[model samples]
Target: MSEPTPDAPSGPPFAVPITVRGYETDTQGHLNQSVYLQYAEHARWSLLKAAGIGQQDLVGHGVGPVALETTIRYLKELRAGDETVMSCRFRWGTGKTFRIEQTLTTADGTVAAEVAAVGGLLDLTERRLIKDPGGFLRELAADPGLLDR
Candidate 1:
């Protein structure tokens, strides 16, 4: 599928909104289970971009990032016309990977879902993890904190 039509308030806080179309809903009318993952991913990417970190930032700097692992928890239902606000937080980041927390909340601030991801940066040319690129590692080290900090 293309993607949900991201509503202005339906996207994550740091994320750019995307439209969630009717096609994303199944017979039950709630968003499809698989589509929920897409929503979370979109919010994560938007968060990274807002953080001044993005695909180009990694590529031009010769670094790549990937999801080493992910954990998700679905808390509530999101029907059509429901406005959601995704919240992407930098949980932790380091030399080789980034750990982020993504929450899809309603406009009222009630949470709909929670997603946690651990992403690793890679030097694609060398097919190995990128531990340090410019001052990227240092910046990540100085990031606030997270679930485990």
Candidate 2:
């Protein structure tokens, strides 16, 4: 595990520890580009799970999280056997949309990748985006400071 960086965001972050697998690397022995996205996705889902939300919970509410856009920046190479931490934070956006920021960091705290995603609630039954997501999502999108600590 890595110590939080000085610039790390306030409030508690949802973190998942991961080890780079050989299959996730490339010829150059660094983590594949696509794997970074996978790490971010895992971090996001882990965050939701830590907040008492899960796939079944979303399905039961007839809603799911749909990513509208994502941007990732590769900072350092991660090789097989490298232990790292993936951390995620959520911030509100316009209307129903919210932003998720995730980081892949080395065991010693060196950042390997940074990802920013824009997403919103999707109404599964309606098969459409929800401009005004329900209380569950709205509460999740709210600032952590406003939530019970």
Against the true structure, whose TM-score is highest?
2
TM-score of predicted structure 1: 0.71
Candidate 1 displacement at residue 2 in angstroms: 40
Alpha-carbon shift of residue 40 in model 1 (angstroms): 2.0
List residue ranges in candidate 1 displaced over 4 A.
1-19, 93-95, 132-149
Clashes of each: 11, 0
Least accurate stretch of 10 residues (summed lDDT) in model 2? Answer: 140-149
lDDT of 1 by residue, 1-149 (tens): 12112121232235444445788888999877887778877776665555556677668767676778888888988777777766665443335555667778777777788888877767778988776332453354323111121
Error of 2 at 38 (Å): 1.0
Predicted model with the maximum lDDT: 2
Give the per-residue lDDT of model 2 (tens digit) for 1-149.
12223244556667899999999999999999999988888887777666667788778888888989999999998999999999887765336676677888999999989899888889898888877443455355434232122
State in Å the error of residue 48, model 2: 1.1
- Candidate 2 residue 65 Cα shift, in angstroms, is 1.1
